[model samples]
Target: MSSSRYLTNQFLIAMPGLEDPNFFHSVTYICEHNDNGALGLVINRPLEMQLGEIFQHINIEHADPDIRQIQVHLGGPVQQDRGFVLHEPLGDWEATLKVTDRIGVTSSIDILQAIAINEGPERTLVALGYAGWGAGQLEQEMADNAWLSGPADPEILFRTPDAERWRAAAASLGIDLDLLSGEAGHA
Candidate 1:
């Protein structure tokens, strides 16, 4: 680990009129930030699939009543078939990656099973994909005004309704989505 962490657990709010079909109006939760690059989940994009559907596909018994009704989110463009669970801070799982003091991400089946049984972290968001960038790619995009960065709010990550997450995330940075423009250039 680097002595200085970049922006782990921050929110990467998409600028208005962004042309990227995958990220327009997106609110991403940074899971890892280092020299290797960054990884995040797009919190506002919802797919047609549900959590129960995913569990069944993986042969994991969905015995817990609570998770059956949960909606699965489109985390990003990478590994669309994989599962990533962003949850309230609980005891560390074998494969858990601590994004912040308050949040943890678990990508292993054991965590999924624990979640299926209601033995997992109390607050959680299930995603089926993730956003990633090569070295310096994210920084270049940020420099081009492709994204706005802000502190991540746990409430926004786990409790805010999907439709509202984008605006909510932008609002956290004092940015009004309606006032933003996509064109990027030197002033």
Candidate 2:
């Protein structure tokens, strides 16, 4: 596929018609997209877990109550045990995928440590696991109308409340999701 077809630094808003429980009304931030596959993080599904809990599990010291209280999101159904930090400013890290000039997804302890110390990026979204698609899988899903794709906006990823991201992301594309039918059909 050509670069124009790639979805890197985009948002995949799950269509109302999509029945997949894992992605119903989800807003995913596409971090990487290529011929090999696509990788993203679901930004709207917050888990019961918190950053403090993860810090405890990882044996890291988190002294900031605000940072510790930050909710952790369920990024996807895959690798549920792992953690990913979607942050802005793209700081240097051990393992980070630079999605764009301003954003990156890091899966390293160093970033967590920085966050714990109040030295991390200006904004962040912590999540577990990630959404992945094999070669051509995401393209096929797009063709089936399972998702609405558009350029990703950092405001939606970092500042929007989890409950509002789905509609907000769709609205960014001039779509009011509530007005769309829940059933998908081809013309």
Say which candidate scores most in lDDT: 2
Following a full C-alpha superposition, what root-mean-square deviation does model 1 have from the true structure?
2.3
At residue 157, candidate 2 shows an lDDT of 92
lDDT of 1: 0.85
Q: Among all windows of ten consecutive residues in candidate 2, which has the lowest summed lDDT? A: 178-187
RMSD vs true structure, all candidates: 2.3, 1.6
The residue-by-residue lDDT of candidate 1 on 1-187, one tens digit each, is 6625376889988888676988988999989988889999999898887788888888988776668778899999999988899999756787888887778888988888887887888898999889998888888888888888878998899899999999998888777788767873321
Candidate 1 regions exceeding 4 Å error are 1-5, 184-187
Q: Which predicted model would earn the best TM-score?
A: 2
Q: Provide the overall lDDT of each model, using Cα atoms, as 2-decimal numbers.
A: 0.85, 0.93
Q: Compose the digit string of candidate 2's lDDT tens values, residues 1-187.
A: 4599999999999989898999999999999999999999999999999999999999999788998999999999999999999999999999999998889999999999999999999899999999999999999999888899998989999998999999999999988888888665321
